[model samples]
Target: MADQITGGCKCGKVRYAGTPLDAAPFRCHCRDCQQLTGSGHTEMMPLAREGFAISETCRIYEMQGGSGQSTYSGFCPDCGAQLIRRSARMGDRVYVHAGSLDDPAQYAPERSIYSDAAQPWDAGSIIKAD
Candidate 1:
């Protein structure tokens, strides 16, 4: 694991802690990520969906992606901060946006997914995934 990365939601309405090395981080430029995060890309860590637990209230909303796959996003009900995202097909894995971390710098883009959809400017923003 990279390190002990523990963080919570903006309002402390939710919390999550994990070993950074336990789940590799990844970056995605897919349209779904872009639309959901309101950013060009989403740099996040991938964890077993069950690995995360919340002490506060959270709500989940599921939507269909451009790829026609279901995408689920979990957010803190109080602050409405998107906390994590995962899909049924990728059920075992949940991707948490690095920005959601109390200390965003704790993680860097480990690998880039959907690179073809990535803007040229968003390229070269990756670290070793292994």
Candidate 2:
């Protein structure tokens, strides 16, 4: 396992490092994710609150999630690159945008959620059960 995983925003204004890369990622196909990513889905990897470190301040946006808990999104203020997400529904779990990783090829979504909200044209066989 990698000692730590590192990445940054498109503009390199916001950088982050998550230690002990032990978490599996998942794909979110919800409408909000699609809108945020401008794609069919977004890949997310969860890290402990302390496991992640940031280099600079990021702009945050919050909204009430489906679970009635506030979800916070952190992004680069300069280039508007989305970086992380944290939700009240998922206590202590700070989710990082997999796409922000320096090498996203090292990770893949273990499963997909909110498939019902997936766009009809968004079809793929990426998920594998284990």
Candidate 3:
């Protein structure tokens, strides 16, 4: 991953730039992730919240996370494209959707989260943590 990460919504209504908190990204297979992404999982890259900057305010959706804390999903109101995810349990970082990155191909998930929640058809996609 690049030292400086940048990305935006489909309509370019929402944009963000930040320093990566970790080089190893992860795939989330929680039901909320599947529903939010309309897929089997969501690939996420972590960014330092202190270094993160957003061009515009995003529409936030709040839900209870697996940790029993509040989780927030940030997206473009205009394009309805999901861009970020943050949780009360992990306040120091924000997780950016890999697909929202300017260079999606650069995203390579190193591990799978919520692996037990993976759908049968997508079970093989999970990457066990090293």
Which residue pairs show collisions in model 3? none
Candidate 2: C-alpha lDDT = 0.80
Candidate 1 stretches greater than 4 Å from native: 2-5, 18-23, 120-130
lDDT tens per residue, model 3, 7-116: 99999889999888854799999999999989999999999999799875688999998899999999999888999999999999999999999988878899998999
Model 1, range 1-130, lDDT digits (tens) per residue? Answer: 4455566678887887655436557788887787777777887787655556656477888998666789888888888777788886776777777888867877766577777786677666533346
What is the TM-score of each predicted model, taking all chains together?
Answer: 0.76, 0.89, 0.93
Rank the candidate models, highest lDDT first: 3, 2, 1
lDDT tens readout by residue for model 2, 9-118: 99898999886345678888888888877889888977777767887578889988888889988899899888888898876678889889887875677898887788
* Worst 10-residue lDDT window, candidate 2: 121-130
* Residue 80 displacement (Å), model 2: 1.0
Cα deviation of 2, candidate 1, in Å: 5.3
Model 3 TM-score on a 0 to 1 scale: 0.93
